[model samples]
Target: MNDDGHPTAWERGVLERLLRDTLIEQRRARRWRIFSRLLTVILVLAVLGLLSTDVTVPQVTSRHTALVQLNGIIAPGTDADADLVIESLRAAYDNTHVAGVVLRIDSPGGSPVQAGRINDEIQRLRKLHPNVPLHAVIDDICASGGYYVAVAAERIYADKASVVGSIGVLMNGFGFVEALDKLGVERRLLTAGAHKGFLDPFSPQHPEDVAHARALLASIHGQFIEVVKQGRGERLKDDPRLFSGLVWTGAQGIELGLVDALGDADSVAREVFKADKLVDYTVQPAYFEKLIRSAGGEAASALVKSLSTTLRWR
Candidate 1:
């Protein structure tokens, strides 16, 4: 009877150990399932909330300085993109309680086209919202396309040591001609237009293309100068180097008439605009984006945006 029916002590111990491990694993799996369910519910609720939420210009009860910040490179997809900036500006302008609009600028400049659109919008908004004055306050730097946008404001203010001007237009591209030749690589770009492929980096540089590019740059430069002249009018000094694509400190800019005075946002709001209360009117991303961003999907969003080509104006 003992040989046929009795179980070994080691075998029973092994069975108990296996039972414990299995229970532990089951508990772990249960916890994971519960966590996943809770996470899913929370996400669904969040989605519902976002769907119900409206993205609109917030109304202010009191007269305050509406701060529209041009914070980064003014390109198509950036925060300082013309579309976003113009949206912010339009909201600021439309606000009944907005005493004055302050465009807080800090950039090394980006797309000239984007900047020009923003500048033009500012001018148009000025005419529409004549009661509310607009002023540009330079923080760290406002150069090139940044300055172009700034000029649209009625008055430009900056800190004494702040960088103020680069009033220039530039198109930058890399040249791989020498590297291609060294690597024995042949350039094979076919274009329908005669001059379409002239700027191809892998191809040999031609004098005619160089001359044409310079001419194009000069024409854009002339447009930039005309804008500055119109904006500054009699305030600008009679210095030939003013539009020579040279950056200047705010103090130097004041002397050259690039910046009107030395002041910060606080000073501009309190002393200049006479409104101590500052209200930010920057166009921010919707709640869905912020939620996705918090849950580590910002890279996914950026990747989706990067499917299109990007052209930079340096």
Candidate 2:
């Protein structure tokens, strides 16, 4: 009627319907809001309950214990730190209730000097505490220097599937002089001594230098073999290639006398120590320190790889 024609009943009906629909939506939204609030309250209560719950770390009875965790690249503060490992061993050796020591080793080998230091320290501790039983439980890959360290233990235990033996030294690198020649890149290396840059990749490799380096590595390898013999004694088999830079599994290693038994840390502890409680002596790195260390390790490893590769190329 206002537009110019007639009264519109249909329009009035449509407006009423729209108003009804809007009201229904508002009610649904209010209900959802209430449900959401209730859910949040319940979640908060659950969290508080969990927080208030009493939880206790495992404990040992009438026993003093220590656990030396061998983790990372056998470097300082990286689980396999020699200084930290020896300090823990000393503490456990001195503990009146300990009566035994366990070295929980999980390493892929590392610095010879570090491993040697640990081996020597263990020997010293053994002399100081002859009554204390020292055991090595290989968790995963215990090879080369790791096996060297294990030889110092009174006995070694490992799982059947564990990778155990790499009873030799290895120095790996690459040579890329041909590539450089193709690219027409000149290498400039200066040294006062004639043999100072003997293995320099940029410089032509001399047969004498190659012989010298091989001899040096061979000497180191001989020392490693001697130490292994001193540790395992007659247990080692009559294989010339036993120390020939080969790896073996724990099962095979046991047959080859590389390890004492086929079992894990828990099995060894329970069976040998007659107790279930184990203490870890490895220092726990702070969160920030661990992060920084991880970054630093990556960079150092990269540098070493680069240098070794560059040398081999030349």
Top-TM-score candidate index: 1
Task: Give the TM-scores of the predictions, in the order they appear.
Answer: 0.76, 0.75
lDDT of all predictions: 0.84, 0.75
Regions of model 2 farther than 4 Å from truth = 1-61, 309-314
Clashes (backbone N, CA, C under 3 Å), per candidate, total: 0, 10
lDDT of 2: 0.75
lDDT of 2 by residue, 143-258 (tens): 88888888998998888888877777666666778878999998888889989887776667789988988887787888888988998899899987688768788898889988
Give all candidate RMSDs, comma-separated.
7.0, 11.4
**Per-residue C-alpha lDDT of model 1 across residues 1-314, encoded as one tens digit per residue:** 24878668888888899999999999999999999999999999888877432336767889789999998778755567687888899888877988899999999988878988999999999999888899999998999889999999999999998997777767556677798889998878889988887767677778998898889888888888999899999999999888878989999999999999998778889998899899888886556745665686657645644543233333
Which candidate achieves the best lDDT against the true structure? 1
Model 2 residue 78 distance off true place after TM-score fit, in angstroms: 2.8
